[model samples]
Target: MGIVVALWAAILGALAVAKYRKEAEAERTRIRDMRVVYELQLSREIAARRRHEMTVESRIRRELESESQADTAEQVAALRHELASMRGHIEYAISNTADPRRELTAKPHGDVRELVVSDNAVTDADPGRTEQQHDQDVVDAEFETEYQPSAHAKTR
Candidate 1:
């Protein structure tokens, strides 16, 4: 009876140890799975943060680009306005007859004979003068006069 009871005690102790070891292994596996899930969650959070940062940076770049384009447009508009003003000034200078000498020289005369005939014989009869010579003589005459005949000439 003693031998049987000792054998039964040994078997029961072995069974309890096996059951405890099994339960401990299952707990370890559960802890390992939980750790893996936590790591995955942390990685997901990091990825989301990176995506948000990228989005913000892209929006900033787009805004800066738009602002730069707007500035360029304003500069172009200002330049165009300046160009138009300069063109208008050039046109006015060309059209305004402030100097009678400049106007007379700009007129086409075939030669000195034609100029003398057109002037109604105001100067001496010099048939030897050419058109260019007559133009130079007119210019010299205008330079000799100190008093301006017109208001526009005085301003000039």
Candidate 2:
């Protein structure tokens, strides 16, 4: 009887040991899996944060670029307007201005004989003319006061 009891006790102890080891191994596996799940969750959160930051930065940069372009456009428009105004004023002055060449030409020295002699001498010296004469003539014309296109000369 003692031998049979001892055998039974030894078998029970072995079963309990096996059950405890299996339970401990299962707990360890659960803990390891939990750690893996936590790491994955943490990585996902970090990725989401990066994406959100990038989106915000992109939006801000686009807005700033657009604003800069708008400012440049406005400045260009203003410069164009100023240039047009200056051009208009220049045209008005040109139309109203006296010819500088005409003003420089020697006036008749109030002596008819002297004027005739001078004119004759000058014409004789330049009997033959070239492109220089034309250019000088244009210069003279440019210096004359504005006159009616149809008028041959300014009235005395």
Candidate 3:
């Protein structure tokens, strides 16, 4: 009877140890799974934050670029308007202005018969005309404002 009681006591002790080991292993496995889930959540949060920051930065840059473009367009339009006004003023002045050549040629001022006779004699004396002489002839023709001598000067 003593041997049987000792054997039963030993069996009960072994069973309690086995149950404690199994419960500890199950708790460790649950902790590991919870840690994995927490890590996944942290990584997702960080990625979402980065994506939001990038989107905000891109939006700000686009708005700034659009504003700059608008200012540039306004400046261009103002410059075009100024240019048009200047062109209108220039055209009006040109239309109102008289021809300088016509004004200079319209009035005769001095007796030039003696000068003409002398120029003709010199040109007849020199049959071979130089480029300088031809240029002078052209200038003289363009600016010829000869008037007849007054009766008082002719009498003198």
| Most accurate candidate by lDDT | 1
TM-score of 2: 0.53
Per TM-score, the best of the predicted structures is: 2
Name the regions of candidate 1 deviating beyond 4 angstroms: 1-9, 96-156
- Model 1 lDDT at residue 98: 42
* lDDT scores of the candidates, listed in order: 0.66, 0.64, 0.63
TM per model? 0.51, 0.53, 0.48
> What lDDT score is found at residue 100 in candidate 2?
22
Residues 119-138 of candidate 2: C-alpha lDDT, one tens digit per residue: 12232345576656745764
Point out where model 2 deviates above 4 Å.
1-13, 100-156
Using lDDT as the yardstick, the better of models 2 and 3 is: 2
State candidate 1's TM-score.
0.51
Candidate 3 residues lying further than 4 Å off, grouped into runs, are 1-13, 93-156
| Ranking 1 against 2 by TM-score, winner | 2
Position 140, candidate 2: lDDT: 54
Number of backbone collisions per candidate: 0, 5, 0
TM-score of 3: 0.48
